[model samples]
Target: MSESSIAIPTVYGLRSSGNCYKVQLLLDLLDRPYHWVDTDSSAGATRTPEFLALNPNGKVPLLVLDDERRLAESNAILCYLAEGSSYLPADDWDRARTLQWLFFEQYSHEPYIAVARFVRRWLPEGHERQAEIPRLLERGGNALDVMEDHLGSECYFSGGAFGVADIALYAYTHCAADGGFDLSRWPRVGAWLERVRAQPRFSPMAA
Candidate 1:
């Protein structure tokens, strides 16, 4: 809410989530400056009366524009903020390919891997949910294998260049090890993580 006349967006969410971090990653890369209002996604801060008013879903990674346009969903936020930019591909087929990987990340990847990370890291170690760890490890590994095969042939997840696809994929992939998904088995993916880290204006998700 600064009066500088820079009507950029301000993001709100926890730093650890791939969904939240994806928007941050893009903002940093674009050299866009804005405010950050940290929400305790773990403690149900998103579900509080105030935050839920911003997004009925009570989700993290909500984007509040200078004009007060509130947007939700990490992938959709990335798309909205990256319009007319290189983060989105100019070609029709390439754009579709980017969306393809994003869809995979949410349905095929996040449900298995990110949820595992959340349960393992955020939840208490002795929580009843610990019983689900074994399944998450197995399914998460399978998802990583799929990512490995795809990344072996391309620099980024889409268009062979860094874009929204990379932003979506990198958010979780970089933190997969927290849930016991080892990168050693996927050498190419490991390399891809390094590449993401080396992006010109890259910022750590937890930064």
Candidate 2:
């Protein structure tokens, strides 16, 4: 924790989740102090009464302020934590552009890439869900291709600097191969990953 984060909020999240890791990454990038409470939505953890009270949606990456104010949704948390920081764009148009990419990540990217990783990591190979892997990979690859094209032109999703959009997309895109999506084909996207990793105080996803 940095001196800047001395009295910030508590973060309840699963260490392995990309959604949760995005918040963790932003907090680290901003040098914001936060208490990370390990909370797994899998293994029936998020469904528990205590966890449900925090987020009725029964999800991880929930943020609770010192005053007991709670906020859910991973991207929303990123926006909150990055406000007034370099991670968030000061101009209105650039900020909205950042949001545009964030929305693309959740809808067009994570649904395929992240879900494929979850199934592959947690489910048995012979399980019925394994049948979906091919389609997931196909969709995930398409999302990656889009990223490759965009990243080929702009150094970062924020246009000039690293910001929340880059973090949001980077979460799953970096671990894409875990879902069986071959990343070697997208050189531009791969380079962007390295750029984001090179940022100061950047932290890896917890093991």
Please list the residue runs of candidate 1 whose C-alpha ends up more than 4 Å from where it truly belongs after superposition: 1-6
Report, for every candidate in turn, its global Cα lDDT versus the true structure.
0.85, 0.89
Tens digits of per-residue lDDT for model 2, 1-90 = 233443678999998999999999998887878899998777888999999998999998899887677899999989888887888899
How many pairs of residues collide in each model? 0, 1
Instruction: Pick the lDDT winner.
Output: 2
lDDT of 1 at 52: 86
TM-score against truth, every candidate:
0.93, 0.95
User: Which segments of model 2 are wrong by more than 4 Å?
Assistant: 1-6
For residues 1-91, could you state the per-residue lDDT of candidate 1 as single tens digits?
2434335668898987888899899989988887899998778899899898999998888988777778888998887777778988889
